[model samples]
Target: MQETQDPVITSVKPKSRFPKSVPYIIGNEAAERFSFYGMRSVLTLFLVNQFFNPTDNPALTDQANAHANKLHHLFVMVAYALPFVGGMIADWFTGKYKLILYVSIIYCIGHVMLATFDGGLSGFELGLLVVAIGAGGIKSCVSANVGDQFDATNQDLLSKVYGWFYFSINAGSMISTVAIPWTYEHFGPKWAFGIPGILMALATIIFFSGRKKYVKVPPQGVNRNNLVFITWYALTHGSQRKKGEAFLDVAKQNFDPERVEGVKAVYRVMMVFFFALAFWAVWDQCLSEWTLYAEKMDRVVNVGFAKFTIYPGQLSTFNTIFLLMFIPLFNYVIYPWFDKRGIKTTPLRRLGTGLVLTALSFVIIGVIHTSLDHGGSPSIWWQVLAFLVLSAAEVLVSITGLEYAYTHSPKSMKSTMTGIWFLVVSFGNLITAVVNGLIEGGGWWATALKGANYEWFFVGFILVFVVIFFIVSPRMKERNYITDPVIDGEVAANTNSL
Candidate 1:
């Protein structure tokens, strides 16, 4: 697993305006993140304020909370789903750059609608749908395109590029979380959402301005080929044939072995996608119920040190900030330490750690909420502590997982892999919606709140799924090809799992 000699590696050089290119992308990412998160941070609050209750009555607050949670999950579900369609569009017709530009415009338009459409419930719902489509489309396309900038040669620089990317994202989150929440408190939704919409427009323009310098990979025409599908269909049917099915019916019928191998790789990744649903079920609530929980908590003031108010939604920024910090920390410290000990931080191991850590993070949250239910608000330090652990787990899992999927996936299926990643989140959101509905309908939430809190129930269910995933992850890693710069052109020797 460890090699002293450097492998034959290709270096992706910086473009002519290398400095400018990085900033442009980073700036665009930062602004776009701000726009997206800003709107999201306040969406639940807005719904609760407006449509959540038709009349001002304290008794109707529960109804409002239920409605807001439903809307939040629905927005999240659609947001994750649209990426599949957006990725397909990029892989087929317009390519990433053009698709980003087009979808971004739609995203901004959705924002504008959100800011202005303060009419009836129907108008608000319509606005959310538009924003979801636009935002989801952009998310699906832009993120994949970020990887398109580097290839085999410049792959080593990916860590650094992604580091900056994470930094920009966190920075944007910091501002949006603080500012948007504040705006919603002081000003109206129009002002709060309008500012983010304006920023999104600027982000789009900035991305397009740097278009000439970016590496633009045309989509691989694999899916467009009729022979591939015909071969796949034959293979599918052949598997269902009676005992002693003939190879001539499947293997010999216009099937290419290489294409078969590619398909197997894609399927392997998709199989692993199921495990991720549990992770997202826990992870995505950072924006939904978790924020609501935070809104209800006591805010700590450190007037002796620095005078400033802390918002619960702003705490999510810790994930991004820690991501930025961990990018360099892992690359410089952890990777080298592991390399010295003759250990490879395989994606499976990373993902497993992420799941465990995420579960632990929720446990901490459960404990804090338990304290709150016991007639006392917990310290903000508890939330911060959980964030620290969660962020560490995120570095191990989500970042590594993204790189793993990108490299393991065949070039033709890069966008497909991205879409699959989001699909896991979509499924998770769907599960969350179901759980929320059940909790609301059956009124089982009160039972859990009696002890260490009901949020623990969600955490426990997710952790159970995660433990099962760990049992299977070793085999999953074995199935994937190690597509690292250190192992160029050398396929993994252990491909028996496939």
Candidate 2:
């Protein structure tokens, strides 16, 4: 018999234009991010101003801020952590498309709870929890869904698509970061929260409209390829290992070799994500501690053409705005410039360089904090400069991370690997929450972290992680796994299956 060919595979020529479904995905992402970031932009302020009573005492104000910071970070921790669950469901049960659609309705409902219960603390907390669950549930699926749209034929566009995906995220974030805070200030919490709810509904509609265009990969269902079972089997069956055999390699005795190798790839990628925890710990502070610091600074800006005061929450817009600028700059001018000079700007190099920049951003924040501690009002321009550095780091670490996680992942475990990447951010926020709890407990560590020392301590903390990343990263081998086009109803071969 003549060999059969998949029509989808043959239709796509090499180096073809972006997949047809890309615009819809990009649109959905932009609207979804606007909703998420809009609600988040005003969260800290809402907690401090509305949920808690205003206090005249400086000490009481400080306590409220610390408490708000703890709640904020904890909320973030839960949001990032639940992606693991989302990823599993996508891989084993519903697949990416169905799960994202179902969970996004829950996301819209969470926003409703926030808008309706703006006055009560308990209700607000409930709303936040629901929103976190909804947000986290769809997180891994949406990103991985973007990757599923392409196969071997146009795999070269993966990096560029991811870049545009990230760009849309920042573009939505930049607009919401400015607009939501202004809404909160003028029309109050109900309107501000409600606006994001509206945007999220639009996001859901946008995603659904593209259903026919998407390359829908069916869920794999429960299988021996499950990483958890493979690891357990490996641990229990270790005695069966032959001489000079590696640990995970022992699993090959029972499981398919490809499945076992996928598990090993997960382990290697996770090791890189481990060092990323410090970066996230420092990065998320831009929302909480940094916003509080902005409250104490002179926010007035007198431009040659206009004059206005920037709200504390609005300061976050600078990071998003800078990201909009930096993503293209790095992709076009900077990376190309380095390539021409015989310098390779690899993903690991970008991640390591980002870590160093994260530390430097904090160093700048530490100086401003020192000036504030002395009762000197610093320019908001100083905070802007710090955000500039931090935004550059975000481009290197976060955008690159999305591409790294997708590419390094095995064909069978893409969503799971992406979930693990988000888990790194969850752990980073956990560290921040722990530090805040310690400070609230009033201990020696608290004293060390007091006032300007807080920023300095984080600076030292991130620098140490940066050094550790540089030392360990070069040792990690790279694996690029691209899914071959669909054959009949099944995904075809995967390049570099091992």
Candidate 3:
């Protein structure tokens, strides 16, 4: 095997203030998220009102609801699943910077197709496919890029930066969630979709402006020590393994020890993502299932000074609003409070607690749905309460998951690991889509979980996974990997530490 050459490195010095490139990345993410969520905020309503069933018939309405829900989740699944492919490409062919810059252009084209092509479902579905590919291709690269900016010299700031990164995402989401729905309602699909396309274009430009400043980690070209080849060799050549050795250890006889260990690290990170699958299955429903529920409830609000109506799509803004509040609260107050008392808030602990909170949020939704089924006109505030709980869970699970994925994986496979994390989200959405289809098809489970029972069934589904997460979380080992700064054209020793 040939020696792997280290790429030219540009990074901050020891104990330096925040990296200068951070603001550009954060700004780009804010605009990109605005574009993506803006389009998604109105997707189900657009599909139902224009494409799926444009009739007033009650039976068709019911069918449209089910179809819209399934399609929405299916789109999310495809968007998320493609990240694995994108991550592989980024890790093997194009570096993160190039991959993100080029695919963003494709992402903009997808939005253009949605805005300009008013022909029918064929064009619209094609646009969705393009968007999914473009979006997924850049997903893992963008997040992994955040971690690429730091090394051991300034690794303590990683968690704080991740928190602010999440804050930027929700800030974008908060604006678009409210703005895009109103645009869809008053302006029409063309303008509603077109506006987000413009935002995508802006996001691209913002990213490009930082071209000279970023720490560009060059791609690792195809190597014999790739995880896939090692895993396959281990599986196929098991006869060489010693008794009582771990499965991957069999490959160590023929491969570099460090490379083999990196494969094991990848496996460990994937195990965590396996349990996170159910969390996302329930979490992504905020835009689809929860919005649909909001449509049925009373939406009027009285604030003494004024009265206004909250649209179903706008109801999602509460999640964003709470996210903006909770991120700072948790980072500044809650986590610090825990630290002062000698309590450690580990990533797995945050994730487990988040799953329980997610379950509690669904319970609130189930109660509201039950009231609606029994002819009780409940206020929309009940749904807002649910969003409050769900948003807290998101802060814990989603943000920490990003930090965890970046920190746990080897430098060679950071994007690949992050992509796998997203693949878990894809599977979660797939579960939701499949369940919606099954329920709509009227099977035994569907009959038993009809009406408000549907929400309760999901609550139980999530709780089962929550229990599994806790049971397995304690047994998993944790590792933190940070990049080693280059010195005088020579790479320093490895800085991987527990």
Instruction: Say which prediction, candidate 1 or candidate 3, comes out ahead on lDDT.
Output: 3
Q: Tell me the whole-model lDDT of each prediction, alpha carbons only.
A: 0.72, 0.85, 0.84
* lDDT (Cα, tens digit) per residue for candidate 2, span 1-498: 899877764454455679989999999999999998898888887888775435535665555666778888998999999999988888789989999999999999999999999988888889989889989999988888998999887888998998899789978998899999899889999999999999999999999999999999999897766788899998999899889987888888888877777787788778778778889987889988888789889999999899998988899999877877898799999999998998888888888889889999999999998998899999999999999999999989988887778777677777667778788899999998888877767768667778888888898899889877777676676665653333453223222211
Off-target runs (Cα >4 Å) in candidate 2 are 1-24, 147-164, 209-216, 339-343, 406-409, 473-498
| Location of the lowest summed lDDT over 10 successive residues in candidate 2 | 489-498
The alpha-carbon deviation from the true structure for residue 487 of candidate 3, after best TM-score superposition, in angstroms, is 27
Which numbered prediction scores highest in lDDT against the true structure?
2
Q: On a 0 to 1 TM-score scale, where does candidate 1 land against the true structure? A: 0.82
Give the winner by lDDT: 2 or 3: 2
TM-score of 2: 0.86
- Name the lDDT value of residue 264 in candidate 3: 79
Off by over 4 Å in 3: 1-24, 146-167, 209-217, 336-344, 406-413, 443-446, 473-498
Task: Estimate the TM-score of every prediction.
Answer: 0.82, 0.86, 0.85
lDDT for each residue of candidate 3 in 100-169, tens digit (9 for 90 to 100)? 9999999999999999874588888889888888888898788779989998777899888887887888
- The per-candidate count of clashes, in order, stands at 3, 0, 0
Per-residue error (Å), model 2, residue 409: 4.2
- The window of 10 residues in a row where model 1 has the poorest summed lDDT is 489-498
